[model samples]
Target chain A: MNEADILAVIRDELARLAPEIAFETLDPALDLREQVDLDSMDFLNLLTALHQRLGVDIPDADAAKLASLASLVAYLARKGAAPPP
Target chain B: MPSLGADMEAGALVEWLVKPGQAVKRGDIVAVVETQKGAIEIEIFEAGTVERLLAEPGATVPVGAPLAMIRTEGEPAQAQAIPPPVDRPPPAAPTLAPAAPPSVTHPSPAGRVRISPAARRLAAERGLDLAALTGTGPGGAIQLADLPAAPPAAPAAAPFDFSQMRAAIAAAMSRSKHEIPHYYLSDTVEITAARDWLAAANAERPPETRLLMGALFVKATALAARAYPEFNGFFENGAFRPSAAVHVGMAIALRGGGLAAPAIHDTADLSLETLMAQMRDLVGRVRAGRFRSSEIADPTLTVSSLGDRGVEALFGVIYPPQVAIVGFGKVVERPWVVDGAIGPRPVVGLTLAADHRVSDGHRGALFLAEVGRRLQTPESL
Candidate 1:
């Protein structure tokens, strides 16, 4: 699995958690804070799910990079763990 | 999701505590969910019509999971026909046919209200009462600044009153005083040199970024801990857990005699100016009761200052597991023989109370000496 697969899973899990909005088609360039109405608890839940499913440790120091979808994909790519094309 | 009480993890859905189509008030526990933690009440704040039920008796979900669709009261539920998620109870068919033109405009009832999402979020985080706000925005929507600056706390109804907050504090203090063996040491420091350095340093910085006396105290405490690392940790579960980094909690007294101590994370890494700015900000938030739970806990060491109250000497009761607390007394002018001549000099007292089980008299004395030295020459930080 790679960045795209991971991103897809994230979108699905987020949508499942809070179905009030249509966030599936949101652009990677859009800020997560702006695109989806996520509070601190939601952010924590998102990270917990990612860690459980992807075997990644999003340390508090690096957590800021997960603020947007594009940044997350780019970070995963730099780590040589991008989602499969 | 199961609502959590004081001790519960998972809860059984007992029943719908509120009736369908009935208006529910904010914080109204509309449902009761029983668990090992006990019967817990589920609550919400939005004023809305219960369009559908998402969970039934005997079923359970984690806390914070969406459990129902609450459409604004008086708004046509089907006018916004977003499909309800699975496991949610389905609503009856729209009273008006789907083909009927939408009759209501459904304009946000608060006319022309246009608060920024960010402002609204901040208000929520701080639990500010939006209804009390006189908004400054074009639509009379509350701006961030327009939100009440402090947490809403009403006066206790009766004399000799103790709130739940006071009860919790009493329990915590009782536990700390009973469990922690406290040994104390106090010293006086002549800060003539340190004051000069601090004044010079402030002169070099921007007005908004000057280091205040509180920052100097925090920096000195962090430095003193380096000389006495054992004091820089928490004692928990019958053992001492040493912290990799020292986070100093600064105690702030709340308006009504209750107290809060919000930790200044990594105070040592921050420059004096930054520490000053952050300290001021955190202190304000503490008084406002705006700090998150994370901010309130996990301090490696703690400090309390009664200097402003003109206290000549004071010692704090140990906040347990955190091995030590340092207190500062007010600086006062006294005639002292410095370099052989008598002259009035500003002098302050330092007090340290350490866990006797973990810290000896010698170590406590050493920590106090170092703190006095640093207070005398705080520019070293």
Candidate 2:
């Protein structure tokens, strides 16, 4: 529903995909893939996590639309799905 | 017979894939052997009828030990199934031990190699080709006694060897570095088109059926190798022998430790989707410790990709026998300069390590460039 909520959902899923990545110290402006140890498989999983968490189905064509943390949060907020605390 | 790895002195015949009276063909797996890497399905070399299974499944035999009696085109099979008097009676047949597979280090002495783990590890570190060294262990098995002990823990080279595998890799890589004159080449390929194409292609497919970058690399390398014969063949006996079909070896790092570069047969013939499926299957089988001897032995060219990890470029050593090895680095979005313009584009660093004895740097550079060119047009690959 909001920027903070979308960020929380994406961050939770990314952390689940890559446990070694410290989300608390992560820079949202940087490329999420380069910031963590995420590969193509992990990336696909991250999209799945976002879909399940925020109910935002990201089409493959729209992958570039949500590549960074800000873009993912903005994309989810646009979808109008409120994230649970 | 199969050399599972460089340190493999001999393999234990775990099971027979083909029985007597079976019609066999070249490349048919006739037997399964337990090697250091795990069980490898040994392939038959000639077309024939398996007249007799010479070695029992439990026997740990030498590298060149005959495992079967095949009746070639003109040769006739014996009316009786009984085999001729052999030097050693076939060892006690053992059932396939999939539940608890034993390592080849402690193979049975009955017509099989009986080298100790320590001796095998030591011989590997000393760079003595086990196939060349005569075994002096139990029943002529090579042992630590046979190989002169380490030189009182050498000052620099002294360290407790990790595994027989690490030593084997060290031996093979050292040989590659010393003997083969390797020439290196690297090119940063723009993979934006390939990545975009793959995303669009996988959009319709199920999550489980999606493609990975490995498939694209294999397909691209296969196409390039077809154009450059020097990079797609065995460099041996001071001569280069080119293979017509593309059997690209994909290097996969095992979950626990070592590496296996198994061949994906007929890579050029497969579609992108099919290539992806094959890659997934190969990676699964390799991680699960299942490798076909022919697949491991028959790679005309190798592709080692540190997929989505570490540095921007990798300069690799050509696997011995294979004249060339293609290396792929992580594909990431970078500030790529286009036609007088700059923008973020998906870029992948491609490197080729080729045997200088077979080809010079000029041809190797062209081969890398051709691979990049093919990747640029992902649909064609």
Candidate 3:
């Protein structure tokens, strides 16, 4: 899948997890935590949602790496390409 | 009968988890009560044999009305607690735990309906009569998974509306603001230590098992509540009765435009990890229209965090009979001073709306300060 496809998948999963978040207007460069109204539980659910929708495991060790939307979208593209076994 | 909330004067009995002749211990969920918000599983505070189920299912009873006739331990014990025969190995052992219903000798709910938790919920929501339905689950039990395909379709459900729910919430919040003499206090605490600790802790966990800042706020507020009794208890009849246990309620907005702040019983006693797990389950079930009766009834204090939307602070009104409510706002980087130097630091606004009858401004300030101090030392929490 392309980068936009990966980002779309992430956005869909996030919508289900936290309906209050406005995905369309979020700045890609801003941290997801700051850009949208989400708690730690919401963040955890986002990661879980992505895992369930797409067979990829974003372990807790990489939390900071996935902070911003750009980072999350890019990392997800790579994970979607070569998913962890 | 337990008071589910400030707005709730009475509730309809939905289902009884226990029955007459059943021996129950403290903290056991005895029944489910239907309020305006939804079904709340009621808990028995005193351990006893249920003499009778006073309030039948579907009956609307007042808050203080007796739902069950409980015979305490001090009373003559008809139900004997027999010690296990240590040396003898029986062919099969009977499980006494309430959760493991299948392992019991007679895992029946007496003459009452024996429906699974999920089925019971669905039945309630769909306005189906479970008593009229047949069970296909193990030991004639009703499971949600199988029940949908068990038999003929249930009659069309009553059209539940959002307007009625909105009215109920408005009534409760309006009553709180009207009667309670509220005093407000706010403090900004630097959560760099707490935030750093949480990130480090999450790095060691799987993504699915990470902790949240809300959990830390809950635990910290609970610890502070223990020291400052003024901010943790119910107010009634022009007198303040302090609660011994710290059951902190997390205010969760419902999917259908209502609010439910159910208690996480004994918050002061729970570790940070356990509290996080409990909050997750509570939030999930609440939104899914499932709440335990104890959670609805036993909150000494309520906590709300409005940080997700970049809100700087939330000054919430006290939900009376409960005298106090705590709120946390957005955690943002600000210019903070440390050791006569200013630099960027992560800070959160902690605000308390407490009853004037219970304490004054000085005491409230101290309670908020204690919460800040607790957050500073995350290791202790």
What range of 10 consecutive residues in model 3 chain A has the weakest lDDT sum? A13-22
**For candidate 1, what is the DockQ?**
0.01
Candidate 2 lDDT, B1-381, residue by residue in tens: 555543345667776656677787776656667765666667666787888787876787765556677787777655332221121222222121112224443322223344544454456545655666677754576765577533322222312122645655666676677678888888888888898898888787544566777788889999999999989977665678898988999887753357778889999999988888778667645654566776776788999888766778888877777788999998888998889999999899899999988889999888899999999898887
What's the ranking of the predictions by TM-score, best on top? 3, 2, 1
Q: Lowest-scoring 10 consecutive residues by lDDT in candidate 1 chain B?
A: B98-107
The worst-scoring run of ten residues by lDDT in candidate 1 chain A lies at: A76-85
Q: List the residue pairs that clash in candidate 2.
A: B60-B112, B60-B113, B137-B141
Clash number for each model = 8, 3, 5
Q: In candidate 3, how many Å is residue B242 off?
A: 1.4
In candidate 3, the residue pairs with backbone N, CA or C atoms under 3 Å apart (3 or more residues apart, or in different chains) clash, namely A37-B308, B40-B293, B41-B292, B41-B293, B42-B293
- The Cα RMSD across the true interface for model 3 is 7.9
Model 1, residue B275: C-alpha shift (Å): 0.6
**Judged by TM-score relative to the true structure, which candidate is superior, 1 or 2?**
2
Question: Which ranking of candidates, highest DockQ first?
Answer: 3, 2, 1
- Candidate 2 regions exceeding 4 Å error are A1-85, B5-8, B25-27, B45-47, B78-162
Report the Cα RMSD per candidate: 22.4, 14.3, 10.8
Q: What residue runs in model 3 are displaced by over 4 Å at the alpha carbon? A: A1-39, A52-55, A59-74, A80-85, B18-25, B46-56, B68-161
Predicted candidate 3 versus true structure: per-residue lDDT over B101-157, tens digit per residue: 011111123346767665676665555677778888755777665554322222322
TM-score of each: 0.52, 0.67, 0.74
lDDT string, candidate 1, B58-106, tens digits: 6665444556667766777542211212112221222222221111111
The better candidate by TM-score, 1 or 3, is: 3
